[model samples]
Target chain A: MFGKVVIYGVGLIGGSFALALKHKHLVREVVGVGRNPHAIARALQLGIIDSMASTPEEAMRDADLVLIAAPVAQTESILAAILPHLEPQTVVTDAGSTKSDVVAAARAALGAHVAQFVPGHPIAGREKNGPEAAIPDLYVGKKAVLTPLPENAEHHVERVAQAWAACGAIIHQLSPQEHDRVFAAVSHLPHLLAYALVDDIAHKPHADLLFQYAASGFRDFTRIAGSSPEMWRDISLANQEALLGELDAYLAQLTTLRGLLAARDGAALNSVYANAQQARQRWIEAIEAAEAPPPPPQETSE
Target chain B: MFGKVVIYGVGLIGGSFALALKHKHLVREVVGVGRNPHAIARALQLGIIDSMASTPEEAMRDADLVLIAAPVAQTESILAAILPHLEPQTVVTDAGSTKSDVVAAARAALGAHVAQFVPGHPIAGREKNGPEAAIPDLYVGKKAVLTPLPENAEHHVERVAQAWAACGAIIHQLSPQEHDRVFAAVSHLPHLLAYALVDDIAHKPHADLLFQYAASGFRDFTRIAGSSPEMWRDISLANQEALLGELDAYLAQLTTLRGLLAARDGAALNSVYANAQQARQRWIEAIEAAEAPPPPPQETSE
Candidate 1:
């Protein structure tokens, strides 16, 4: 648990982190730092943090941990800006979707102290924005991916893991490159596809009628399309290589499906659907099983 | 208003239609039919219909209107089986997803009486099944597409339109083929994609880890994938041609996107996302505006 945590960029993730810390009695003081004066005021009014600091340096002065939660594009610059004021023992970390660039920036800015930094990504957010949307239970039962905690100290990694555990997050460790590639397939590329589909639908001449006929299926598939463009633009850029790779794979699969459909190949379509059906069934089962409590151990002769 | 209507297959749509008819004082008698004896008993217990019949023919014996609300694949056979008992004056219509096939089936089954059979598709259904999922407002603000009416009695088409209106649906007319093509793009292909994606994820060796990291975005996008597989399978087969065309178009677009991503063309990616953003924004705006009340008409006293 973090005794004193300073959260940078009091947006959705950062604000949620403050609440989760409070829920677990994990932190004594929660201070927020952000560029927007109004957002800082609102976060204070909403009681998301105990206090506000005018600058990142001011916020991290005596903090045991510093969590830089900001737009991916701004993460490196913020890390560089805040490095000079960090305490030698303070564990610096970030909650950014993309990690490679941020890790490189942290190493450059903090030098030897770079070993204290842990790059993490929490897979949770809503289309709605601001501190108001932050819920203490947002991170509960969610996965938090930590990329390559430096070999500097076991205590540092343990402390970071404990912070995530307090918020009810299951921690998974991977290299920064692995983290990027995996998320590109699961998250970033899907978001890009949703955005593109929505745009295509909008530009159609029969847009109004088409949307009117769009069922809950279309609405749900395109909900992420309603997300902030600026944030996604940065993410799509930061993880370009992996995202492109994923996009190619998905397109190749889509093309095969199209071919089957075009030929009116019922047998082929059925095979594809059956494969998908079995896959989804397994996922659904896995999710349901995870929600249930663990089974008691079987009795055995000693 | 229908003085007495017989609803065949008293499931979600049929049960909801019973409620709507009662609410609008459109029907004096609402007889329900189901092949299953238990389902008939259950419909009666739920007060979704005034009485229950064992077969579609028996239900329509004395009814002014006969509504076929069964699955799309069963539409033709059900029509064929009921044709012998139909009254010449009765206004028979269907509420299936694919209009052309059902319309063709009606023509084949009922011969000249097919003119009384208006092929329609209602754009309403939850991820739920059965009468218990039935709600009076199920079709409220949803679209009900009626294919071009056959050269028959004008009053028959008017009767069909009124039925949908009473159920709180906005009526739109299109050719049977047009309805199938449009819905193939907006509904069928989207569902296919969702099922495939969820299936693919399920098959991954690290599926549990992937699912644990699944957020609300993925859950929403894949909700339709949780739909009744048999039902979706039937729809996929019924609208094979148009659905295939849509699949091809969608694949082509995805291929182009993949190419741009592979090339690491930031500008192209940015443009794609920008278009998607603008399209979705306009769609939301249009939908909102439609849901709002119309402005008062100006009077010219010249």
Candidate 2:
């Protein structure tokens, strides 16, 4: 898909992209940029990328494709730093979880050339982080949402789709606002809830004992609770409005549920439980039908 | 440890226990009793049990130890049916999730003989069920709570504890009430919440689209929602009071959270998120430290 590619932040997503590029022969030369020299060295040693760029600008100097995979808050600053060095013909996109901020940052950084940039979010990752956590098939059968700018070139969008396709992603197109709203419900909100649930249980009087008794159900539900606090903090803040809206909606429903249970309203509780059960079944069937393998069993050999 | 062991339910728990008994060299013979003749035959064919008994009465005729592993609602009826057949010297016990109900049933059915019937709950299982999901080390490093009758004989209690110890379980003696309350927070209540969450999402106007965009986080959060509805329904009904209390409490907290999010109270939201993150981390660390290899993943070698 491209001759040379530059990834600005080579963490889990970035590192996995590098691995996928290798798998599909999508790019010939891979350049990585990260703040930590140790991580850069590790990525190079692990063969995640071919070389390390001394700076963001240096990374994009000879690259045909530029991917900003930094934290959402850092996207604007990094884009600012790399824009001056980018070739006019270069194509740029991001692998951020949030879209609005990144899209706005790209517009401000590239101005008239903003069409070259596509804001995208790959709906795949693990609780684990860093380049070491990157796996070869990280994006296999996953959804990658692309929010193309009004001026985005058709060829550029096509190339972006092609790159994601090579990485084993099914592409979905939406506007930046729609992408943010959808992800807030599908991803961001769930993460926030997981974190909140963990916190609620941890601060309880029987915290240690409760944790001791936490079985597979609790472990699975709260798995994302162990995510990078810094990254989640940034995401929670960046997508605050939509995430908060989701939080409120979930809470309102939960409150109504609480009332039902308190009143020993068996019919109401049973109705909700049955509905939830059926919904989850349909979702599971949809997932299974997609023929996507689960991320390898946790703590098992990948 | 046991010469003739009778398991009163030839399903996942009983069958797995039989396999574990053989694996640990704790029993000479495992006699499985089930209402379903086909399940009994399947259990024997799978080598989960050495022999099959058509009725609990037949299975307990010559058994020195009897473990009832039936569904919560059926425990009382099964106990009543098997009580007359149990030898006075038999060390009877149960592997039910909800202790109080099972304990009450044991007391009602066996009267003074209840002292021989220890109510136990093993905190382990897989999403999959049946003898097919049976693994010998299913209880290894898992918690097994025993709620013995207050007048239980020392020898009977010690025998039950030893049996669990042989299966590599960490045994704890708990009051039935305590067991129910604790598990309500850690296990039952969480399952209820998961089912409710998934149901709410499914009923949403955009359910299909929401699911299409669903990623690992939602999948993990709602994983328990895919659990056997029949089993959970029985559990929820059995532990109704405590589960309802926990659910109400959770709902209240969720409502408070909604208020904070609706107002975009960043500080409050941050506190909730941070607390959850910290709690989840501690819980995971504790579990990892205590784990002794999860009995090998049950990957069917297709």
Candidate 3:
């Protein structure tokens, strides 16, 4: 709970966070700060925020919380712009996909105030972006990862965690490095591969025919490729080292498969497929078990 | 449209076709032929077929149409077994993923009766298999590709098309070589990549952590990897050459991306993602347009 919450870059993630805070009455007033007047106006009309401020200085003047929800590449500039205006007690946090760069940026920009910054990434979104796409329950039932810096104060981390919990997000903690590596393998790499695969087919001579015959499997596999290109492009570059490591690992696996295919090793191929299939089944089962409601309280007999 | 429709290998595709045919009143009788007595019994009990026959010989004795919906690797043997029992006028077609090998098998097994066979690859299915997973509308609004041989009569091809049309499938005609190449790029190659990606993560040191953080994007992207391993294994080997070519092309694209990433060429990466995003949008629009119903008739000034 806070008196005034300032949300910078009021797009999908920022607007959604503002809406969640407003819905839960966790903040007395939600103030949106962004360069795009049109988006800020839309957020106001959508009731995602109580009001709009043209500058971070105006928005964070008396704010109890400041959420930097801009693109990862812009985190440094946003922090630099807003740090001078923030109150000493204002807890600063971010909703960036990549963490290391943001942590580095906080160190460079916040100086002594780095203790107020808590790095966070909520693993939830859709292909659509913008304030109009924001939903009140976007973070509900989703995992919100917190990668706090060594300089972050315990109170700042606790406040951020409490806010996300109020939004119905299950929280997980990881070191910045571990967080980057895990996300690079599971999220960033899949996005890059999907984009590459779609572009490969698009460049083919028979692209029209190829796409016409592509069924639901192809559609589902490439759905992420339809996400905001600019955002993903920034993420790919910001987390370059970890992403490249993942890409290499994935390529190595593919190479092994290529060799097996060339050698016509059906048994080996079957083994690989079976292993992947069983692993996916296990994951599905785990997720289903977690989601399944507790057996109606056991209905103990009197 | 037929006196007796015999469906060999009464699993997902075969069972669905039988149910669709019966639903459309396209056949006087539906007979199932499968080695699995339990599955055949389930098919009969579910009304996916009117009756059950223990062997291909018994099922094809008076069959007017026969649909072989087994795995691609089994196509040759199934043809060899069924040819001796098929009535002279029987118009046989298959629902295998690969076309060239099935055509080859038909030529080798049918000998003089090869003209009765039509090589087809229905572009439809789900991760689930077996008769229990079958549904009447499985092929509705889906593509069913027909690749007829030079030895085949036009009437046989026409019959297959009509049957699929009755099941609400739109039919496309392509040469066997073209069919295999297109599907290799669109379907087979994607499945292999998904399987390889999943297995790569499963083999990693931090596999549990990686999978725990893996979100909807990874789930959708790898959904096809959960498919029947034996069936996909057979398809991979059956359509080896085209798939290998595709894998090479895909790898070449990835190599280019790796270079751009290493060089930190943000503009180039953004361009690739933007191009893919736009192309995917166009494909989505095309599909939506095709699937959209005709506009309501305008009211004239009466």
Candidate 4:
């Protein structure tokens, strides 16, 4: 529990963190800070935050915790801006989609106090963005991956984990390299594929006709294409190496599929599809099992 | 209105067709036939059909309409089996996902009676299968694309269109070639991409970890992967040429994306994402517009 928390970039992630902490009575006050004053004002009006901080110094004053939930592109700048005012007692973390970039930014900005920062990425969100999209339950039954740096003190990292745990999230730790690699396969690659499909179709002469006839399958497949463009671009660049590796692997998979199609190998094609169907079916079953998100990792390896 | 309807598959599509027809009181009786006698029995027991027919001959008797909603692989066989029993008054149609192959099968098997067969693809479905998955409103507010043969009599095609209309589907016409091409771009390509992504991840050594971290985006993106593998295999081969073309185009699009990533061209990458986001947003808005499925096509091109 914290007496005061500062949430910079009071959009969906920041706003939701504020609400989640308050929902559990885990914090006495939530101070909001953002480059867009109007958004901060809206957060206050929406009861998402108790107060608005016009400056990083003002926001950091007596702040027990600082959650930088801005776009990954602003991670370094925000960290640098708040570093001068950061207190030794304050534990800092971020909800950025990419971990290695955030870790690098924290190291570059926090100097000797870099141990105060714990890199985190919450695997929860909706297609909508901004403060209005924030929900107290966004992280409930969800996983928050923390990639603690070598310099991070154990207690500081634990505080960050506890904060996410208070928000009903199940905390897991992965090294920055592993986090980037795993997410590159599961998250980044799929986002790129969705965006590519939509953008490719949109560039066509018959794009309208294609979109018009697109039914439920198309709707769900391309839903992620509707995500924030700027945010995805930042994540894409930050994790470029891992994502490109994934794209290459996926392209290879497509080539094998093309070979099957070329040969009219229905049996082979069916096998591939059946394998995917089984795996995806199992994944859905696990998701719908109605059991809560897995309890805190049995015996933290870290 | 039909005096009696024969549905040869009794799976999701055929069963839903029966339920929808009965729901609208547009048919006097619905007869089901399938290789799976148990499923056919279930269809009758569930009231999705009024009777079970052991053979095409039995089902064809007194049948005003025969809907061959079986897998695409069985198209020619079903057409061959039913041709002798298909009466002059019985207009035949199919609910296959691919049009060109069904048209070919109709020509090869129906011969002179091919004119009675109208190729159609209902632009709707669920991930579930079997008679239990059928629903009366499955086609409500959905578009059913009918690729009418040039040899078909206008009245026969009209009867087929009327059957779908009774089930709350809006009818539109396209040449078999056009239908396959457009669907390859919109439907088939997306399904393959989804299946490919899931299969690729499933094949990896860290598959469990990747799947564990996969959230809502991956779930929606891969939802189609859980579809019947045998059915998709048939569709892929049936619409092979068109699908391959679309796949090539998508591969090219992915190459462009790879270039953007390699160059770290964040601005261009953002623009591509923004374009897709805008188009998808507008399309979703149009779908959400309070108005119903576009009232039957402006004018029948045929």
Locate the minimum summed-lDDT window of 10 residues in model 4 chain B: B290-299
For model 1, residues A151-192, the per-residue Cα lDDT tens digits are 547787777888888888888888888788777766887788
For candidate 1, what is the total of clashing residue pairs? 1
**Which runs of model 2 end up more than 4 angstroms from their true locations?**
A22-25, A36-38, A44-62, A84-86, A263-275, A292-302, B23-25, B35-38, B44-59, B263-271, B292-302
Q: All candidates' lDDT scores?
A: 0.79, 0.82, 0.91, 0.91
Evaluate model 2: give its lDDT: 0.82
State the DockQ, from 0 to 1, for candidate 3: 0.90
Interface RMSD after interface superposition, model 3: 0.5
DockQ of each: 0.45, 0.47, 0.90, 0.80
Give the root-mean-square deviation of each candidate in angstroms: 4.0, 7.0, 1.6, 4.9
Q: Tens-digit lDDT track for model 4 on A1-302?
A: 89899998888898998999998999999998888888988999998999988788899989999999999989999999988898889999999999888888888888878889999999998999999999999999899999998888999999999999999899999999899999999899999999999999999999888888999999999989989999999999999999999999999999999999999999999999999999999888877774556567688668
Clash pairs, model 3 backbone: B1-B26
Worst 10 residues of 4 chain A by lDDT: A288-297
Q: TM for chain B in all models?
A: 0.94, 0.93, 0.96, 0.94
Whose DockQ is higher: candidate 1's or candidate 3's?
3
Error of 1 at A297 (Å): 14
lDDT of 4 at A131: 93
lDDT of 1 at A222: 85
- CAPRI band for model 3: high
Model 4 per-residue lDDT at A113: 82
Between prediction 2 and prediction 4, which has the larger lDDT?
A: 4
